[model samples]
Target: MNGANHSSGNIIRLLQSASANAALYESGHLQVVRLGNQLFEELSALLEACGELSLIVVENELIIDGRPQEYSLFINRFTALLKARGVEYLKFQKGITRQEVASLVEFLSGAAGEPGEIASTGHLRFGYLTVAAGGPPSDSKGGERCAAEVLKELSLKELDRFTEIYRAVQRRQKLKVSGIADVVSGFVDLFRQEGAPLLILAALRDSDEYTFTHSANVCILNLAQAMALGIEGQQLKDIGVAAMLHDIGKLFVPEEIINKNGKLTDEEFDLIRQHPVRGARYLMDIPGVPRMAAICAYEHHAKFNLAGYPKLPPSWRLNLCSHLTMVSDFFDATRTRRSYREPLELDQITTMMLDMSGTELHPVLTRNFFQMLSDLKTPS
Candidate 1:
């Protein structure tokens, strides 16, 4: 195996062992002490190999070595165990002492004792152990005021209006074209000011607000991508509207299923999978809504490899808007914290998307999107 993969595997194992050690210690198992020692030794070896090891927990993702560690069911549980305690990032450098490791395990044991409890420290230090607080880092330019304050407020307000429109549609009210148009115009203006970074930075903000926030983030990402691809004029508006309303069908879904903190049963998943068709049907009723919006709603989940949902009939194909929206959808979804998992680091998010480029997403579009993201994210 390659060094990177080997390191990735060791990190996963170390995390699993650490979590187990915490569980053992908490139950007053005497063997926990021995296990804890072993865990520290293993950690030391890993540090030797890698120079430093950091585990950063974002909303639903566990990041190691600036990469997204592939999820294992057990690993997700362990990640949740850490996230629940508000343990954001753990940094281990060479010569990290066993005593420091013991302290961390003890701390994890205490934290594991109380599920879903938040730790208060922004940065906690225990000898050689540094547990920096979690959540997205402060905006580089904004400092005390977030970089996207104005943009975020504007997007959220637009999202609120868009969300209400969806609700009105659900209630069978008259379609409001003016409000939706205003939202698209507002997004156009926002994009004009800073291009992709304006929306990208805003999207990177914490996703605790959910549905509405997710729609806005995806819309921004989609719009930015669309603009980059020379998709302009009415076409851009159509794509933006499509991106914003891509998940509107979720409103028809049960809150219990959509927001359930645990794994979904097969039946629950099937029900959840119907959103695209449901959303598309609703969009079809809007007097002036773009057909591409409805098309994107229907086929955003249809994979490039034809492995995705809302099974297509023979010889059927996906729309360009759907391909664009699909990439944006998955990118923003994984980038944001959801009810069930943490958000991935930027590198991790890109790597996963690149890996999916050929099969799950449009190869050219995915590659272009990553290039755009890289340019936007680079320090100016």
Candidate 2:
């Protein structure tokens, strides 16, 4: 390995050891303190050499200083711990102190409070990585791309990653919930920072991209609505994941049936309609998959009046997360170009949603969704 890679790997190993020691012993334990000091010294030297030290966890792998690390047990354990604690990125500035390093180890070890409590201090910073538009810019003009263009590109890249994750679910591979979490984290950060719905929503470039784009858009819309209602942190992240995976059952349906240009026969349509149950069951079986995701997967299509599908009992109360996902799903599906129809304008979709309110959709949530949209449209 090169000098940079070797140094980064060693630092991560030290971090892993320090965190383990912190978890097993008291804060002032000699081993923990010693490891923390060593970690501080090593990280300081590296930060001085490189100006900044960044460790990002992407898809369960570590990306050190923007370069991916070679897979190893230490890398896996360290990244897993970070992800478990909802941290996707860590940045160490040159002036970081030994005390701050010790605190970070404790935080990573779960001995300290939540990740949010220790998000940043002095030279230590940690949070989700913004979903990048792509690799380095092609030329000088690339720096001049407008915010919308950059967001659209980032949305497209996220769509590609989501599609891969969806395919993995279809193949019955272990669901990488971390991948979904990372995508949701990006949306959450975008909402928190930019707070512009239009810029965050992806434009449909091709009909073939609709499935993933629709899910991605729904996630964006759901996060917007959730944040407006004061939902934050892990709950907000769970809602985003649920919205993104609400349509995953469609992966089990045959491609021919899903992409049919003509009207579907009853049999094909029945199969299509069964996706909710299939998706819920699939999600429920996966360990660490949020129960909200399964509930939303099953209930998003069930309608507010309980007249939609799966023939639930009259007393079945839908989950709040499911209600939110339903509103987002309907909005995105109507706004996007489909095989059977062209995309609807905002006004047309608004009218349709208003007409369906309380019967096919939740009355309060639907109105809140539109009111949020109206607020977005109105000038400041």
Candidate 3:
């Protein structure tokens, strides 16, 4: 078996043994210690498999190490025990101790009595194994950009909502920023605490769903880049909203053309090119939508070299947010999966972006953007 499968089996065994020990601990402390020692060894084995253990519960689903564990009797029991105590996520690093295992057992046994109790006794942080769930896990510098299950689920849901709202706006209905606002805030909160770089948790983009996923992923990328740029508050929120809705006009184009697996005719290509204007108009008509959003929607397709469609004045300077969104939109588009082709690798994408810096992208912003990506890739 592969290492992941082997490790997953070990995790199942660990959960089973831990749950059993927790249930039996009150009867005999010595027996519990022995069982807990076994559990500690199990964890050590799994830690040796992967660098760390990350457990997440989304509804009834349990995911470990970005892969879902197979469902079985023990998994069901494990889920029930955690839910009964309001525990939703867990993480463990190397060198976990036997005492920590024993404390975890006690916490799980008593946690059921407290409503929404996030952590176990002795004030053990969830990641540290006293076993409670609250806030984002403490971040380790240059760590993998894994996010909480709640945040991943929330981002997906918000993407769905954003797509629906875009359809409504395309139908000439007014846009509501309330749902979008909440999603941006949630993203900001998680980003600040988790320190995860954008696109880390993005789902693979299918051909038909490219617009929706791309919009959402661009927003995530944009938010991270913006945060790195020291942009904050209302401006940050506006940028996120705008980035997510950048391609809203694509909804006006025929789906067949968008999803075509072959080359497009000139007419079809022109219709494809009109999305920026169409999307910008949609946003401009909305009352609460910011002007920057409309401008970004309009100009996201416009080249930094002033060579793209919907030609503007040669001397016109685009908004800073527009420049940022343009880079973000291009990065996400090139990296998106499609029926016609696979997504590009990060090194290739970064190289391509850097090549386009002076004439097709903002030189300074592109430099900073790639630097941030490079920093994220280095081990801390």
Candidate 4:
């Protein structure tokens, strides 16, 4: 498996390929990985410090195991370099010859060139940060994002590792138990470091992609409701953990069921209903997952009207955190797309949620909840 293997049972019927056929192996070397003025230099220094890399591909992410400490510093340097050249990288990418690239690199490095006038080409080339593409532009695709720009923005924010971790989690056959805990830890740390509520809101609402972002958003909203109800400290963190994973059940649901194109049959609905129970079970295995976290997962779907699942013990009561989690969970879910149903616009989602407050979500938390995220979208 150390080599590229091509097979076509084309039943050569008459012809066969010879392993010894030098004629068959043209272009034997791997393609050169082009670098901008920045990444090229970083890669050079890193290669000089570390020997050959042990290439390991787990889906779309990369890990260079030999140089552990150097990796972080190299990534940081690469990120800064990319950010400095962000928009420029996306602006001029076509008919760019090798000499042109070299000239551009020299200009970026501030060497001895009177800056030549760049003709507006109306097309930009891309670097390959996009996992879908191999980090570089293939043939020019109109209006496609430049991979370098995306990497540059992420580098500025110091979020490359987060993106890497998230993609890695998504690629695994299943999310690892340890991985989920690690991510949830990162979420809590962000909350702790945040001094302003606006920062927390922006961190959730802006920049983050759909799935993980939505999950973290709901958890933050749920945590706010906890504070309004006077929950504090470790108790608050416990509830945050539960809210973060309210949908762990969906991870186990078939992609078809989760992405269903339209209304589901009663049988399909039944399968969907099993997620709350499933999610609670998965969270139960994690070490130190408080009873509050597990219980919220178990009962977040159970209604205040007593119309939801795992019918409460004769006296099994829902509490502040559980009720709040239910509200935030649905709020983000409605704003998101589904297989059978397209997602509602934000205003439409809010209006519908407003209508269901007292009966479904807790009335007071629902009221404070709207206000909690009200200052959210306004520019700081």
Best by TM-score: 2
Which candidate, 1 or 4, would have the higher TM-score against the true structure? 1
Say what the RMSD of model 4 is.
22.7
lDDT of each: 0.67, 0.75, 0.68, 0.49
User: In model 4, how large is the Cα lDDT of residue 280?
Assistant: 83
- The TM-score obtained by model 1 is 0.58
lDDT by residue (tens digit), candidate 2, 1-380: 27767777779899999988888999989998899988988988987886667776645657665344666787888888888888876878788888788778888888434544575887887665432233233332322233445356465567678788888877878688888988888777766555454445533334276777788788888887766554555667888889888988898999999989999999999999999999999899888788889999999889989998777988787777787788988888877777788878888888999999989987867876776665333111
Model 4 backbone overlap count:
10
**How would the candidate models be sorted by lDDT, starting from the highest?**
2, 3, 1, 4
- lDDT by residue (67-180, candidate 3, tens digit) is 445667877777777767766656666666666666666667665565434443332235221212232233433244353343455655666776777677767678787877
Worst 10 residues of 2 by lDDT: 135-144
| lDDT accuracy of residue 35 in candidate 3 | 67
Q: Give the TM-score of candidate 4.
A: 0.50
Query: RMSD of each candidate?
Result: 18.8, 13.5, 20.3, 22.7
Error of 3 at 111 (Å): 64
> How many Å off is the CA of 51 in candidate 1?
59
